[model samples]
Target chain A: MPTGSVQHFLHGSISSNDTLQALLHLLRGLCEDAARGSIPFLDQEISYTIQLATGNSSMSLRARRSLMYEGYPWLLTYYGHTDSADSSRLVAVRTCVQAGTSDELPKFLSCIGFKKDFELVSKGHVFKKGDMRVIISKFYNPVKDPTHPDGYQPLANEYLVEMSAVSPKFCEVLAREMHTFAEQLKPLVYFEKFIPESL
Target chain B: MVVVMLISWESPEGMSPGHANEKLQKKIEILGGKILGKWDVDCEVYSSLNGIVGLSDTQTTQPANLGGATAPQQAIYVLHNSNYSLSTFAILEDNTVLIADSSFDQFMPHMKVFYKKGQRSDAKGNRYELNEFIIKTGVATFGGSQQKILLLEITYLLSDYVHESIGIIRELAKLLLDNSFPGIETPITVREDKKFSPSDLLLQYKALFSHVKKPSTVK
Candidate 1:
């Protein structure tokens, strides 16, 4: 694959079913000229935060393994902060590999010697609008698998909505356009950038 | 596991460009560095906006709040090298570098392409197979209408130890370029260390970029 474009993302949340429907309607109208497709699958992602044993120092590594209904069985992703803590913006370099089996997860982690700090599971529906991708995902606590009859509880009632594109240069322009599209869905699904503590 | 040292060069002593190219090639032949092939290494730099955290290739601990969450001291960059081997250089704020086989295009949905440069060269020697000196001469192009810099990169693939090979590479460089190599006294040597990161490489490239972008004195 040609791996050289910088991706930009704007994230928000959709809390109500009515807002989702309205947002979808507005997306269809805006993406009419762009190639559109539905990712008719419940994509699951398990993100493993890896940390070096350095006390409470806030720099560590992260790995994410994802599986889609129609996609490959195991897609492993690893990334981390390449710069220092004082940079104005956060930039990370990430690489993805296809693991033949699920058993390779532990082996991969051990080889890198990064301790698993935390894990989060998310499942979502994806929509591709031209080069832009819109994902609405529901985060869940992985420790409580609903199938295992444990305390399975949704992380939150709101669905995380993300609008992303592959080009860094055009991100601001695209973000502006996305903001306009998101404004139409105001009060329904407000899309903005998510700021995690690590960032 | 190959160690590389990149040295930039320019024509010496009022020598014409054509004559300088011929002289470089002749010197390589004399040193038994056979012509291996040619390479066109292209790279594009992507950075995040001020105070915005973009995609990360690895997990990170939350940075301590330095006073207030204001502008940072260093800027992070994802450098995409589009040579035969595709690679991404993630330069962190603290000079931490993370290199990966995959590109940053997939992760950063919003990135800015600050600069683009293509280094086209005639590569010589099979450092991997023959364990000899690998040399390359190329022209690096930064954005502007007329900005191209000559680059000469020499690699010693025989040993993983950069310190051991530096003396030999320096001797060879002195003979071939006749001290025309820029930064010959302190060539950019990339050695393998736990802390050695892509940021080091980016710093070198940034120097080249600034040097090339400077107003030309030749005109």
Candidate 2:
């Protein structure tokens, strides 16, 4: 895994289901090759967050487990602190690394002293244009059978809209391009690169 | 795959590491083992400022928002082996082993005040193939201390069960090291009804490394 790679992203939220549908429709029209299609993806992951027993600093251990994929290999992603991009960049920059892990990851983590924090499910559609990826997902509490639509509780009434591009070198141009693409979503949704004050 | 790790505690009455390696290589080659390639295993010691809370402690604690101070610093050995699928093994102080994807290194810097205290790498490790088995030998440079320890790791490719293959591994290790390998007998207690796991191999490594770190008794 290359340690120099970074993720440049912007976040926005759709207030309601109706607004989410409107925003999705708007994106379908705005995205390249609208008539082609979009890939629907379901993300069922359990995030094990371990905090230093003495401080507020913490790290999250998350692996993606999707029922749609055969055998459901756990593709682990280790996330570093999400740095708030400066005013000039207008995108949040975070360092993340992805690696292939086995199903014993949870048990292994427990042995090494990490406690399970929470598990959430996210289902949404993904749109891509060149190097850009736009994801619109809604969060839900874990369900017994993720393949089934019922027996799940929604964590939020809003849809999270994220636009991101991963690059090994510092990419100010890519961030600018993402900002311009986000601007096209206009009145339907407004994306910002702010990290909350509480974080 | 199952792995058994052993350390050559003494190199036949004052032989240097290089001389010992040459002797072992000749022995392995004479046994009809073919040199496969070179391997590298880097071990790093990292101590967490606010260490991860133990699971048992969390279960037994009172149900209050317990003050987070007074946690002991946790030290662990992180091993990266070139042969595995980028597997990163963490051997905690308590002999608890955790295996994670190699990319887990990216998250280490984010964990509260986690920093590397010492590091050692065996870049000249050798991988050899014998009939129905694989062998890896390396010399670990004890971090900052400049001490060298001989490492021998054996894998039984034909059998997945450790219990079924323990006798073969022990015999092979003894023959290759000329009976100077003391760690050979340590892994026997773990050979039971359970199948071999990579973590078990890592625990053996921790024991070997710590043994080399012990202070001398002569005053």
Candidate 3:
């Protein structure tokens, strides 16, 4: 319920590599601190990336990061997403997360009351580009289990959360799309089964 | 075979039909072919050529075909010191070939780059190839989808100048069969054809690169 007690620090810029490396270094320390605490972070899903220009069409200011969502494995990926009109920028990011129970990632994140932690700083624009947006989010408090009724509630994971939004106003758009992304992010615990290791 | 030497014709106009090899390239040129690259089998003679040469579109193309669609072309040189013999068809009957624009083309042909024991250049040990031969033909028809079969021929080539640029022989066979409509995914029935499998070629390629032992299931 307290405000300004825990400030979610973010380093944003039109420059991708610079912003990403700084955020990563900060996240590493933040996760380390959060893990050391009594916070009940069953698993922490951290993902970030940098994107490059798709082709010679330099209309879209080249260097930037696209929609970064939490997923399994702290691995880097360079792929393309396209449609009939234009091709998405080439992106390479690493999604690193600690191992935990399968199908439990979504519930774990929800139980920690992460969605509610965005009440304060989660209202501003994280970053943006042509049809691209980045939103900042965080959850420090844990929401107790309703079924347990009488157990001492655990502290949910407390770490910096910064995500990309497609529009110029990233924060507001993410707040609107939060429900959809929450459903998507919840199953990240089982995302491992989708791609085979031997491919 | 994860890797294979791929050879596309430079141009039939320039290539004479004298040697045993230039025949396919000549055919490709007359047939209006698009030469991707070439896998030289007689690799033992690569020492005479430059370590690696990048040819612009104009350089690779014939005088008439110059200034056409061609990415930067680069040739990789290979050399081997260890003892290994040419792969005979009598040994096996199954293999898978692959080539990749990025990664995960292990089943496709690849050029394995290495630092030869004493060679000064990096390209000396690199083996280039396109293993997956998806021979395809036919166009989409009225009632059916594209009436084409994707045949995969897993082949590999060793670049030890002494050897025939890894797998140039197999590619030559595939190139020669261009007119016959050899499907890229053509199934090589081991029982009927009595030919070695893709896995056998894979091990042979690996053995050329290192001391890799062949698996039991591979024939």
Candidate 4:
């Protein structure tokens, strides 16, 4: 759940210039491929949307051993800001795939952000100010919780505390682990990179 | 009772579990079959890149089964007959896949139901079927996001050492049985998308069937 604030830009220190270049590189290549096949991949731009306070206060707990993150689904967040007090400067990088492939990219992007690359076996946590917060573990699926006290409900609802001030810390850790992660993120900065030669 | 089975699925990060599970649960729905529950655990890594999902023998003296293995934590095991284990199943990314714990397999093997290849059958039909003495270890990362496992669209086979179905499913026959586990009349039928329904579970178990099938993909 994102705060829906522009603070996302200021928090993660994400760069729009670099990410945009990369996305252009990728989109251009995709277009070329589509053209070769006589299939125009219209709507080649990335899309952004926010999961605001929908009043969907649902949550599930992961095993202490298997918990991949602490604060989660309930809490929405914005990533990397252009400046502190980011009034309205945050970006969400998402590429469209055929309906069949839309579900695939989420996992791939997560793998790109985290270093371990392993599906989070452990739902980790970080306690701050005596309040337990979501730990930053990448590739973790928050939906696998079967032991919901609510007794078997939707896999969605990750009962996590929403916090922007500290949540960015998780992103920073992710960025630190992957020097180019911030650049590689599918955000404004990532959109700028030139697609690799392979394209 | 561990189900000692595997579940595989497609991935979409941050996609709400409710959303994905709703989709998959509807897909799992049956004439009467339903999802009882689901759980997520770490994905298991096997030496084989294929989705075989077998663990290497940690010890040599004992069987390849995790409990029997007697080596350091780093040990690997050989695969037993993977047949009779689910035979057919699905994995959706971030979905709550309720895998029976090892405890469930003991009772499940004795569980039997009627099923057919092309037509719906009754309890008295010739297509009577049931999973062998099976157990689940726990929810595992089955057919996971490729980045985590690094191997997808590869070959896989059930282990032979599973011991429950080994005798009945001779190499050739077993392969035939599991591989051909009847694909539900429809793959996208909804089972337990929103909540676990007991009737759905009983109906599915009773309706599901396994057959003589050997997996050629494992090697």
Candidate 5:
């Protein structure tokens, strides 16, 4: 089989809500010609990572399962590392399955025999501009202590801004466009690929 | 990248397990097929999106729901080995395969777990460097229920051509089981007429599990 199209991705973060709003305003003007309406980022999404015991240590063998937007629900994706090891590249083979019912999720996971390791929840919005897709999401970690008023809280103040397209050929062009857009809001928000120490 | 041919072995009407095992073992020994090892394999079904999301109706001019709909027929599954060491994501719609990694969970946010089935089987004879004959008998159950359907799967592994290997496997089965085999004559061709990938093995397991879960006379 055909492996499907290779998706190119660029990651950046805005530290505050004010800067996020400013960047969104700038994008609205830049993508006026090909703007499709906005969609709820992620009303409520829970992500779980399943790992294999004998998978290569250097290379993590994990599959991600997410339930996003109570109305839309199930999305299952498998991620595999590509030949390139460049952290900035972040390329991988992604296989996806869209389930029709909530009942299918557990059955699918059990059939595979993978155990859930860590899970995180997130909420966000998605903006589509022609072939490009942008998501501004805030990830949250569940609180272990029962004393905490809220069951979960934002992992960080920063909001992840990811721009992606399904073609690698569009990487350079998209990068250039995103960079110029970032420059316009430089002082308000910084958008660039910044690798975290843990990842 | 081994090619596989699947043959189902159903015991004659009311034959007991002990009697069936004795006959199968004796036949294999007569054919000089040595037993290699035995283990259990588990399979699970998963989809790309969760819940009852509907796909857009392209025939009409209605606005598309974007990510709000689920396409059940397009769902893919990740089949794991017994120890969960190896996972293969098989896309049934297009027959695509991806060896999943730890980051899979992060990338697939809409993946939902479905049904699970486990099989216990013995490995016999080296068919290829990465291939072998597998005699499997198992039960597929949904959720926490004790109810299960019996399943039998025999796999002949080869890496080169599936059509050719399947013909060889048929002859082997005929020698071992005489007229007892299912005698399915349909050609077992790889999807898209491409060389088999590692994930193709898991596809076989998934197909068998689905069959047991929902048996259809026409399928």
Candidate 6:
């Protein structure tokens, strides 16, 4: 599937693993419908970000390789500077390309004058309703081999719940719809846009 | 899928790149090759951020930089060929090549540190089709108009077998260049193997750039 440039997303986090399990069960029930049935998604991916830091300005590119995807495994996304992290529904110009299973992306980025900044493993479950995707994932720092099951250290004690949609252009209706979806998951986990710099 | 071979021609100093390109196109036409369309390959150079950002070795103790900094910081190259519309990112220092979507070029501006050194876009050329073979003649220019190099690319579109088409391509080059064949330089990746793919063309282009710009000495 072709990814859209305008990415609309809202993020929330649950502290306890018990709450996450309960939320997953609740999500399975919420997303259940007779026509499409209940769709539970398992997402296991490793994300690597490459940065080009000029003395004054710096830019970064991210590549996410899915362990679950056997055929088309890599998704390279470029987040433009126009993206606003402060908005209620965080909007960003995220251009994404689905690449083949070549582990040469990091090599390629390095070839293009970008240095590997960080690497993290994200394992999660996904719930879909229409175009909206609700992802609950945890991030881990790879201690040894990133691809190995036992080769990681948890970054935090919380599971991040992200509701997002990719659109061709900024659509108010899509952002509102995502906000509404976030509201439905409220009390279980409060979805808010947390700025990375502040954290 | 098509396989391509790139040959560099040293056009006479006085002849402008445009005139040289026209001369090659005429020769291809005389050989019963029909002009298919125009094709071009452009390259943009970007420098690394480490030296520019003033990050000392002690402060840059990131795991990603461990052992990666031994090689001197080399400028990055983002190359685009109009025919494939795919972006080929290469660093000639280590012979690393990555093929990505053309839209990847848009992300360059967002990277503050890797400043654009200069760009060469005048590597424009024409594409010709002769029988089952495809011929492309491009003038690689500097500063938009000063043609520096002439490149001849021959593609065998029928199959991926590189050896099978070499004889026919040689025969066509004999006609096209009037038996004065420019040296055919195969990229390191394809030098040993006989199989071919679209990415091979990008690698060939990278080889062309490497010949022109020594990656180690590049600023």
In model 1 chain B, where is the ten-residue run with the lowest total lDDT? B120-129
Assign candidate 2 its CAPRI class.
acceptable
> What tens digits encode model 6's per-residue C-alpha lDDT throughout B1-219?
656777766655687756877888898898799988998887766555455333232222222111233433555566777876645444344555666666556555555445445445447778998888889998776553443777778887776766666667667766776634654534556643556866666766655664563311111
Report the Cα lDDT for residue B153, model 4: 14
Candidate number that wins on lDDT, 2 or 3: 2
- Give the higher-DockQ candidate: 2 or 4: 2
Model 1 TM-score on a 0 to 1 scale: 0.45
Model 4 CAPRI rating: incorrect
Tens-digit lDDT track of model 6 for A140-181: 774546665545667787888878777777777887887777
Error of 6 at A56 (Å): 6.7
Of candidates 4 and 1, the better by DockQ: 1
- Which residues of candidate 2, in runs, are more than 4 Å off? A1-4, A15-36, A44-64, A67-85, A97-119, A143-149, B2-7, B50-73, B94-96, B112-116, B119-124, B181-183, B186-191, B214-219
Candidate with top TM-score is 2
Better model by DockQ, 5 or 6?
6
Comparing 2 and 5 on TM-score, the stronger one = 2
Whole-model Cα lDDT of every candidate shown, in order? 0.49, 0.68, 0.25, 0.23, 0.46, 0.62
How far off is residue A5 in model 3, in Å?
Answer: 34
Give the CAPRI rating of model 5: incorrect
What's the CA error at residue A179 for candidate 6, in Å? 1.6
Looking at model 2 chain B, report the run of 10 residues with the lowest lDDT sum: B58-67
* For model 4 chain A, the run of ten residues with the poorest summed lDDT: A93-102
| Highest-scoring model, lDDT | 2
TM-score of 3: 0.22
Candidate 2 residue A67 C-alpha distance from true site, Å: 5.5
Runs of candidate 1 exceeding 4 Å displacement: A1-199, B47-76, B80-84, B92-94, B106-131, B183-203, B210-219
Against the true structure, candidate 4 reaches a TM-score of 0.17
Query: Model 3, range A25-135, lDDT digits (tens) per residue?
Result: 443343334334222223222222211123221110011111233443221122221111211212212221111222222222222111212211111123332232334
Q: In model 6, where do residues sit more than 4 Å from their true spots?
A: A1-6, A15-61, A71-73, A78-102, A110-118, A140-157, A167-171, B11-20, B49-72, B86-92, B158-164, B210-219
